[model samples]
Target: MKLGACYVAKDNELKPLREDAYFICNKEQTLDVVDGVGGWAAKGGDVGEYARQLMANVIIAVHEEYMLKRSVDLRRVLHETYFHTKVEGSLTSCILTFKASLLHAVNVRDNGDRPDMAMELVVRVEAGDIVVLGIDGLLDNMYPTKMEEILKRETKGQAGSVCLKKVAQQGMRCTTRLTSLHSLHSLKLQKRQD
Candidate 1:
C-alpha cells in the first residue's frame, strides 16, 4: 500500500511555469521533484528548458530502474542527467521512495556526506508524519524554524494541504521570484492498512 498523502503544484504567482517539474510514479512507489537553478538566467540560458529535459530523462531513468526491479537512486539519476543533459545551469532534486516501513529520500546537492553503512536520508516513518521537499528558492525564503511552526499550527485536522499551499504562497509572496520558478511539494506519510 502507498504510505503517504501528497500534493505538488506551482504556486499561482506572476511568473510562467518552466523550471519546476514533479512526477509521481505510483507503480514505482516513488515521487520526484526537480528545481532548476537560474544562475545563467541572465546569460540567455533557459532554466525551463533544461529542467524539462532533465525531468523527462529522470522519468525514463526511473522507469528503467523499475523494470530492472531496483530501487531509485538519486545519485545515479543526477549523473545520468548531467552526462546526457546539456543544461546551462544546475538543478536540485529530491527523490522519495516508499517501501513498507521505510521512506528513503535521495537528495542531490553540491556536497553532502555519502551514505555509509546506514542510509543517508532513510527514515522509519509511520502514519501522520509530514515530509516536505522543495528547492533552495523556497527554503531561502522560509527557514526550517518558521516551517515547523506553520506545520504545527496548520495540521490540526485535514489541513495539511491547506497548510502547504499557504506556506508556498507566502514564501513566493516574500521572494522576488515568481511562483512558476518556485516549486513546493509536500506529503504526509501514512500507511494504507485497508
Candidate 2:
C-alpha cells in the first residue's frame, strides 16, 4: 500500500495551536490519527501536546507489538495505547490496519460529555482501491463527492496535498470560525492476492 498525508494548522488569533496528530507505519501497514479535544484548552491544558504524546505512545505500542511478533490487533493496540497515554486531555482516535485483503478500522471518542465508546469495521479491499481517512475539520469542510472528484483528478501520492490545499482555500474564503487544524490521509492499495 502507498500512503499520502498532509495537515494544515489554523493561523487564526484565537486558536493557533493544532491539536491533531497522525502516524503511518509502512512496515506494519497501519495508519493512526488522534484529534485532541480542543475544549481542554479552556481548562488550561495543551491539547496539541497531549495529542502529540498520545500519538508518540501509539508508535511505541505498535513497535512493541511488532517486536513481539504478535498479530496487529487494532482494538488491542488502541486500548493499550490509551492506557499508556498519560496526557491530561481527552481525544478521539482512529486506527486502520491492513491485513491480507481486509482493512480493519477502530475508532474511539473520549469527550467529557459522553461515555467513551469504540466502533469497529472491516472491509474487503482490492488493488487500486483508495481509502481516505481524515479528521473532523476536513470532513466538515469538504463533502465526499468533492473529495472523490479531487482524488480522481490527482495521482494517489498527490491526493492528500491537493485535498488539504483545497480545504485551506475554502476555509480562507469563509469565516475564520472553522477549525484551522485539518489532517487527511490517502491510502492507495497496491498489488496483493486475496
The best candidate in terms of TM-score: 2
Q: Residue by residue across 1-194, what tens digits does model 1's lDDT show?
A: 33233334566575467577777788877777766665647877777777777677778888888888887775565456555565555556666777787877654433342222112367787877766665544555566666677877776554754666567667776774423322223211111111
Candidate 1 lDDT score relative to the true structure: 0.59
Candidate 2's TM-score reads 0.79
Clashing pairs in 1: none
Off by over 4 Å in 1: 1-15, 111-119, 143-159, 174-194
Off by over 4 Å in 2: 12-17, 111-117, 175-194
Superposed Cα deviation of residue 112, candidate 1 (Å): 12
Candidate 2 displacement at residue 24 in angstroms = 0.6
lDDT of each: 0.59, 0.68
The clash count for each model shown is: 0, 0
Mind giving the per-residue lDDT tens digits that candidate 2 earns over 1-194? 88767777777776665888889988888888766767877988877888887788779888887899876887677767666666677666677888999888765534222212456678899998888787666765666666677777775577656766777568556734433332222211111112
- Highest-scoring model, lDDT: 2
